[model samples]
Target: MLAPFLIMLREGLEAALIVGIIAGYLRQTGRGHWLPAVWIGIFLAVALSLFTGAAIQLLATGFPQKAQELFEALIGLLAVAVLVGMVFWMRRVARSIRTELHASVDAALAGRDGAAWALIFMVFLATAREGLESVFFLLAIFQQSPSAAAPLGALLGLLAAVAAGWAIYAGALRLDLRRFFRWTGVFILFVAAGLLAGSLRALHEAGLWNSLQQVVFDLGRVLPESSPFGTVLSGLLGYREAPTLGEVIVYIVFLAITVPLFLRPQPAARLGRVTDV
Candidate 1:
């Protein structure tokens, strides 16, 4: 619960900040007329995200148990891809985000007829990227956890994210976002790795993959997944009491390769202009 909450909070806040920056810039530069386009883009992206999640949930609920497992595995795989890509993409663009936003806004407002549409597309794509990422991660989390706690955690995370974004914009929060993102990137890498392993296990259960079906280890008898601590770990890190050899291998390999790559700072990507309160 804590894991998903924090991850979503950070990711959501990042998206919110981008949108806020663009919106604020437009207002400051006497382009307040374009605000409607940005709002439209945001609403549309949100609607699309909600629709996509609902469609996926509806489809999965109709599947058999094995099929559901396979679906979950696929979702986890997708989530892992998005997670890794987001981390890398942010690392590369974090520094230039404000500049990019300004440039984009300028370009969009350069013309009259097509400006709104262009801006709409830009904002929609930006927000939707984050929305889709959130969808898959939350889906994977909810599949593993069938408790109210999961949704509650996500809601709290989202609220926190919004508040944080506002605080940062207002100079109320003096967080070093570069450092924060770096640490969260590391945490997300591990979480994604764990999800990868869980995905493999799901695939195995669905008989889609049989490459590494051997039992790597079993702790079901000693500390079952149903236990309080075990459940918490599983929810946080995709832990399994009786994980298969394939799952363990996949998890380890993902972490081994992704962690180091994620931790290295791209000095060129650090934001240069600091916002004054």
Candidate 2:
């Protein structure tokens, strides 16, 4: 539940931020009339995301057990890849996103011919990227944990993101986006590592991966995933009471490789920018 919540929150917030920046730029430059076009693009992008998620869910329900496992494994792998890419991409663009967005807005509105269409397409592409990322992550989470709470958490997270975005846009809130993203990026890396391990487990269950089948340790007696605390840990950190050797190894290796690179000091070229939003 917590994992889905945080993932959705981060993804939704990123989209909201993009929309806010575009809207803000348009208003600041006396192009507020373009706001309607922006809204249209957002609506279309959101519809597409919802339709895609629903279609995938319906299709997965009809698959055989092994096929289901394989599908889940594939979704988990895709989610991890998308999550990792999103974290790094945001880090790389955080410093210049505002400037780049402003420039894009200028370009979109530069031509009188189909200027509104250009702006709509620009906004659609930006928001759709974030929306599609959220859809994949949410699907992976839902597949792993089939509980009512997970969807509720995702809804809450998205609502919170919308509120936060509105507050920021209305000048009612001042958040340190740099610190927010930095810490969340670290948190997400852990989440992605867990998802990666879970994906490997899914693959093994699907009969597609059989190596490293030895059990690492049995904590089921001491900390069963069914326990309340253990469940929380599992939801947040992908904790497994009796993890296989491969799962443990992959989990550790993933963190070892990603944590340092993520925490390393940014290059000067990526620093010294106002990223308050």
Candidate 3:
């Protein structure tokens, strides 16, 4: 539940920020009429994202047991890849994202010929990228622990993000988005580590990975997963009371490597503050 919440919160906020930036730019440049095109593009991107997720879920349900495990394992790996890429890329691009977005919009509006198409395409691509990223990340979480709470948490996170984005756009909120993204990026790295371990477990179950099947240590008695705290741990951290040797090794190794990398600061850039200018 916590995993999906954080994932969607971060991703949703990103989409909202991008749209806000675009809309803000249009209004400031006396191109408010293009605002409707932005909304249309957002709607199209969202619809595509929903359709893709539904198709994938419906397709996955028809698979046999082992095949299903393999599919989950594959999706988990893919999600982890996307999550890691997004985290690092955001760090690198954060300082200059506004400028890049503004440039893109300017280019789109440079000529009247196909101007609407250009605007819609630009916003659609940006938003769809964020949406698809969320879909994969959330799918991996659901695969780890299927429940109503996870989806609900994600939905709420997205709603909160939209509200917060609106507030920011209206100049009613001043957020340290730099700090927010940094912290959430760290949180996501840990979550991705757990998912990586979980994926290995799934691969083992699917018979694609057979070695290291031995139980490393059993903690079922002290903290059974059926218990409340255990359930929370399992959902958030992928804590298996009696995890296999492979799972334990992957989990430990992943955090050990990624955490340090995440902590290292990037080279400073000479970018200005976030603004519609």
Candidate 4:
């Protein structure tokens, strides 16, 4: 529950920030009349996300149990991929996203090939990537944890992001976006590690991978997933009372490989942070 909440909050806030920046820049440049095109882009992006997520869900419902397991595994993989990509991409672009976005906006508005359509497409493309990333991650979580709390947490996270974005746009909030994104990127790596383990388990269930089926250890007697606290851990961290050897290996390997990559700040970001100090 907490995992999904944070995931949506961070990702949604990123998207919101992008849109806010674009809109703010447009207004500052005295091109406020073009704002409607931005809104249209946002609407279309939302529609695309909804349509894509729904179609994927609908398609998965027709699969057999084995196929469903495979599907879950595939979705988990994709979610992890997108999550990792977003984290690093943001890291690389955080310092210059504003400049790049401003340039794009300028070009779009100055273009002769339908400026409105260009602006709309630009915003839609940007926002839609975040939306689809959220959708894939949400699907992975929803599949792993079936409780209503999953969706509820996601809704609250999105609402919080919207409020935060609005506050930032209104100049009421002065967030240190670098620290925020850096910490969340670390957290997301952990989340993706869990998902990777969960994906391995799903593949095993689907009979695609059969090696290392031995249980590493059983903690069911001391902390069963049915317990309230255990349920929370299970939902948030992919806690398993008796995980298989393959699952354990996958989880450990993911963290070992990804954590350092996440922690190692880009030289430019490090310099910017230092200069800010």
Best by lDDT: 2
lDDT score of residue 110 within candidate 4: 92
Candidate 1 lDDT over 85-105, as tens digits, reads 988888777767888888888
Cα-based lDDT at residue 87, candidate 1? 85
RMSD of each: 2.2, 1.0, 1.7, 1.9
- Report how far off residue 261 is in candidate 3 (Å): 1.8
lDDT of 1: 0.84
Error of 2 at 231 (Å): 0.5
lDDT of 3 by residue, 1-277 (tens): 7778878888988899999999999999999999989999999999999999999999999999999999999999999899999988787777788889999999998998999999999999999999999988888898888888899989988988889888888889888887788789888888888889989989988989999989988889999998989988888888899999888899889888877887786655544343322
After aligning candidate 1 to the native by TM-score, how far in Å is the CA of 138 from where it should be? 1.0
TM-score, per-candidate, Cα-based: 0.92, 0.98, 0.96, 0.96
- The global Cα lDDT (0 to 1) of model 3 is 0.88
* Predictions in order: lDDT: 0.84, 0.90, 0.88, 0.89
In model 4, where do residues sit more than 4 Å from their true spots?
A: 268-270, 273-277
Q: Cα lDDT for residue 80, model 3?
A: 86
lDDT of 1 at 150: 89
**Positional deviation of residue 77's Cα in model 4 after best superposition, in angstroms:** 0.7
lDDT of 2 by residue, 185-226 (tens): 999999899889999999999999999989999999999999
- Which stretches of model 2 miss by more than 4 angstroms? none
